[model samples]
Target: MTEKDPRYRRAASAVKRCVAGEVFLVPVAAGVADVMSLYVLNPTAEVIWDLLDEPRSLNEICEHIQQVTGEAGGHVREDCSNFLTQMERMGLVERA
Candidate 1:
């Protein structure tokens, strides 16, 4: 992705909770509870989630993931992109 790819931040109304060493994204709004389901993030997703506590570019997230997991750049980029896209679709994250 290019630098033009927008950075993302956690949604204003979403709350994060940890249970049994896993992180979950909980939507908190009147109709949100009914419409949006809670998202349980895996260990790798948890790393991305923590990095997303603030606005960050996809490249930045990929770099961090690579550093943390010692993975290949292309692999990390694809994985992070997919995760971010899913989170954005679920309204857990927004363009920053």
Candidate 2:
């Protein structure tokens, strides 16, 4: 990857928890039952979140997802981009 490639890291303040088959991101200061700051992740979003455990470029993230899902189209790229945008807005992830 090039040096200019965008890399993303999960926010330290956003803790991830998987409960009853659903993935949730709750703020560190927020109670587990708090719904206000809680973010529920869909399956694709959960996959994207899992991939962001470490810093990774958008290209790499989409490529990995595509490989696993066997999707050879632009949808993976769009989905990853949108998910990252939402994560950033929610303070669940950051550009690294």
Candidate 3:
């Protein structure tokens, strides 16, 4: 997906689970068992992860972040965009 695109959701091929206070993402595929690795989300990222339970536009996610953290809209948008980009690269998320 392009960096300008904000409509995304968690990829179906990955599994997400919350253990303790952290969120873990694991790939689900044959032969992945041996190479499987966990991707953990930080507190802020956890919030974004949950928000992505359904397909959502980047602007919508940033709006929720602003409401929850009271951060400036521009800052929240940038942070969320960056986080989404990273998650996409890891195959944890995909364009909706």
Candidate 4:
């Protein structure tokens, strides 16, 4: 993926599961993400997490969110981008 327009995928070292009604990402034992701590995904993050089941460009992700939520395109795009950046920083996702 190019630096300017990256595609994202869920990190191999991380595993996602639902506990009660909340979704969480936990690091596989002895995995890179183990040191990063368990992450409890918010609803927005959960949706993005599910979409990243397969590698996807940011625009594709935003489009899906917009379709599901019927929100303004520009706003949803911006928010989704920011959310992705945060997820990457936390070692939950990586460029594909």
RMSD of each: 2.7, 2.5, 2.9, 2.4
- For 1-96, candidate 3 gives per-residue lDDT tens digits of 566755989887677677787788777776363235788777788888888889999988888889888888877888888899888997888988
Which scores higher on lDDT, 2 or 3? Answer: 2
The collision pairs in model 2 are none
Highest-scoring model, lDDT: 4
TM-score of model number 4? 0.84
Q: What is candidate 3's CA lDDT for residue 21? A: 76
| Root mean square deviation (Cα) for candidate 4 | 2.4
Q: Where does candidate 4 clash, by residue pair?
A: none
Tens-place lDDT digits, model 1, residues 19-71: 78778878888645532577888888888888888999998898888888999
Candidate 4, which segments miss by more than 4 Å at Cα?
29-36
In candidate 1, stretches whose alpha carbon ends up further than 4 angstroms from where it belongs are 1-3, 30-36
Candidate 4 positional error at 47, Å: 1.5
Model 3 quality (TM-score): 0.80
Q: After superposition, how far is residue 51 of candidate 1 from its true place, in Å?
A: 1.1
Span of 10 residues, lowest total lDDT, candidate 4: 27-36
- Candidates by TM-score, descending order: 1, 4, 2, 3
Q: How far is candidate 2 from the true structure (C-alpha RMSD, Å)?
A: 2.5
Please give, for residues 29-59, the per-residue lDDT of candidate 4 as tens digits.
5744463577898887888998999999998
